[model samples]
Target: MNAPDASDDPTPLALPRVPRLRVACAMQSDTGCVRQHNEDAVGCMIPRDDDPLALAGALAVVADGMGGHAAGEVASHIALRSMLHVYYASAGPPPQALAAALVAANDAICERAGADPACKGMGTTCSVVAIVDDRAYVAHVGDSRIYLLRGTAFRQLTQDDSVVARMVRDGLLTEAEARRHPERHVLVRVLGTKEFRPAVAPRGMPLQHGDLLVLCTDGITDQIDDATLASVVRSHAPVDACTKLVELAREAGGADNATVAICSLQAEPLAAQPDPSIRTTRETRAH
Candidate 1:
């Protein structure tokens, strides 16, 4: 036998790298039974290949407007549009970008409210989610909410900036009592105000495969409880879940416009390969 050669030594092959998670989103909005016109707005923007400032992920936003007639709709629309635009247009990390976008949105809404008499004093509740890589950054104002469903457990990621919520936090009222309180709809912090500040998630939440993010105006939560909401999301696909939730809200006597956006993170699919066992044949025959 030949002597063993150093160059022929066996080496282990490196393991394949795992692919990044891709997000699937679904959204719906409805004018509830009581509301004559929908004052809620929902928007989402996924990064494109050609965009240099892209976060390599997606952004979802929900805004609930608080003014009568078309004013409320305009405020919510402006806030949603401005926030999404600023987030994609600015170049920075997710948290900073989200903050800047919210501030810019607030200024834009305020300016519009000041300029137009019909929209004066118009304001809206906003909840935004910036999903980048394996993390999610959340920012919000007023009563709209963001919830996270990881595995079987569900958690509220944002707090309501309403009087009832404040009372509950201060121990003056129980959660149930606050929910049924007469002033539950009074918001303390809302966009379009001269002085407004948003509460941003201090640290990003680590996202996992099968993680479900629920963004919605209070209209949905007002009708369906958290447990029921989570159950619906887990039982159906993203689009179907949104549709079911909105329908449920309407069935529960939706007193306000309902809007919901669902986003699910999933592992990228493996590439497909051609099957050698199957062969194709082309024949030319005289007619």
Candidate 2:
């Protein structure tokens, strides 16, 4: 909520001649100091150099679960898995395809919650970013956020769909007060609701070498300010930036589960080949 007015363009100033760019990515998640279980989930799909979707981009998603205990975890897990699966296989453009994926995930989550009584009202906040060629495409619902950092300019790419956020925008509340407000976590538009609609970025944001795209749950933003976040990312690599950001959130009282994913655009030759599914994080822990 501390970012510049959402009215400003999120696309950074592009270089004169953007080259064949590639993404370097990493993710980290934790239960935090006060939480007994991690309800947050993080995932991504970085395609092979030869894959058709490779130019369309690599996808990264972060979801913050909200129903309580296992129900919340289930909602987030379902959202992550469903989105990634639906996204890669769809043939639509990045913006349209990403929007459809979120809608599908919302339906999937709703269906799961209804079938299981314990998960009756379970829901989650989902934020996704796709870096394709030299452009970044995004779609999200709820308060989980996507941020773009280009050079010294750091901007938030998504808006919070919550009561406190509305008040702040309407000039009824200040950012400082909104952060501490009791209803800050009471989001108005989250996954698992029939009315949930993903807000898709109007167009792909132009990118440049050294540009950094970040996706994270509220835990990280709640505890640290934007200046701090920009500094951590600017000083570290993608993997280390995620680790350091999560650690800082934990140190800052760790009120909820913290999760972070980073995608850095580097001007370099394409790699030979690669493969990784989005659900690896959750499934790995099951072992």
In the predicted model 2, the residue pairs found to clash are: none
Give the lowest summed-lDDT range of ten residues in model 2. Answer: 273-282
After superposing candidate 2 on the true structure, give the runs of residues whose Cα lies further than 4 Å from its correct spot: 1-18, 269-287
- C-alpha RMSD of each candidate structure in angstroms: 7.6, 13.0
lDDT of 2 by residue, 72-165 (tens): 9999999999889888878988998898899899999999999999999999989998877778898888898889889998999999999999
Compose the digit string of candidate 1's lDDT tens values, residues 127-153: 999888778999899899999998899
TM-score, structure 1 vs. true: 0.87
Among all candidates shown, the one with the greatest TM-score: 1
TM-score, cand. 2 vs. native: 0.86
- Per-model TM-score on C-alpha atoms: 0.87, 0.86
* Candidate 1 segments whose C-alpha is farther than 4 A from its true place: 1-16, 269-287
